[model samples]
Target: MLIHGHEVPGAIDEETRCSHYHKENDRIAIKFHCCGKYYPCYKCHVEFGCGKKEVWPKAKFDEKAILCGSCGNELSVNQYFQSGYECPNCKAEFNPGCGLHRELYFET
Candidate 1:
């Protein structure tokens, strides 16, 4: 399926398949901890999926919460934050503006 102009591979397995979380220009995207799914942003999740948004516990910030769309590498929130939104393994550039919504999906 195509999401936000990106082709999604594999079958649509609700338990494991995440939505296309990257825009045409985005190199990476955030994954939803609530469902282990990825979306371009919180808006994308609300527009395409169901349920309340959930963030990883601050204590578990090191858990995987982002996806490197360029290389399919899953990154922990802490890693992404420290890298300034750059994918460590592939050096892909995620939209820096995403940080503005941190509080929406993260505990302060």
Candidate 2:
């Protein structure tokens, strides 16, 4: 699925929610560092992405790697971390549960 011109592989909705996670606030697509592809979640990436998975390196945190499904806002890793689980541009809430798997997408 494409949301705001960004391809979100394995997306189940326009909001970028996927089969593995479809909570109300689950509306973000992460750009995989491994393949430079966007996926709604790590599980989706595992299913439809390149076999190799790599967390976004801390050195590249300034790059825009997080896509806000609500307003199509492109956020850098550092901006997303400082956003408090919300879309800073649209003020939409993000699934805080995502923090549990932070290690999967970001260098920690």
Candidate 3:
């Protein structure tokens, strides 16, 4: 997909996924994930490594994503960290229990 450079800023609600996806063997086969972003779209642990303040450092996030630090033990796409979207993840509010810590910040 050719994303116009001008369109980059207009992408208010867009997700960048593997252009080609298939399942082989016992693992969900996927092409080499091209580095782009890890913006958490939902409570599904989707995160963007944009280095935003919402991005959890390597050690903070964990495998067992139980309760998030912002939304408490809730399971909803809206509860997950997002970019630009008004963040509901607050201290002691929701806890995204996962191996990767989340922060709502962007590296400039």
lDDT of each: 0.63, 0.95, 0.24
Which portions of model 1 miss their true places by more than 4 Å?
Answer: 2-25
Candidate 2, residue 57: lDDT: 93
Cα lDDT tens digits for candidate 1, 7-70: 3332133222335433443555456667666665676667664567887779989888776666
* Candidate 1: worst-modelled 10 consecutive residues by lDDT: 8-17
Q: Over the stretch 2-102, how does candidate 3's per-residue lDDT look in tens digits?
A: 12121121112222122221111111111111222222332212332232234333443332222221232322232333312222343332222321322
Poorest stretch of ten by lDDT in candidate 3: 23-32
lDDT of 3: 0.24
Pick the TM-score winner.
2
TM-score to native of every candidate shown: 0.71, 0.98, 0.16
TM-score order of candidates, top first: 2, 1, 3
> Cα RMSD (Å) between model 1 and the true structure?
6.1
Instruction: Return model 3's CA RMSD, one decimal.
Output: 13.6
State the lDDT of candidate 2 residue by residue for 1-108, as single tens digits: 989899899998998999999999999999999999899999999999998878999999999999999999999999999999999999999999999999999999
TM-score of 3: 0.16
**By summed lDDT, which 10 consecutive residues of candidate 2 come out lowest?**
45-54
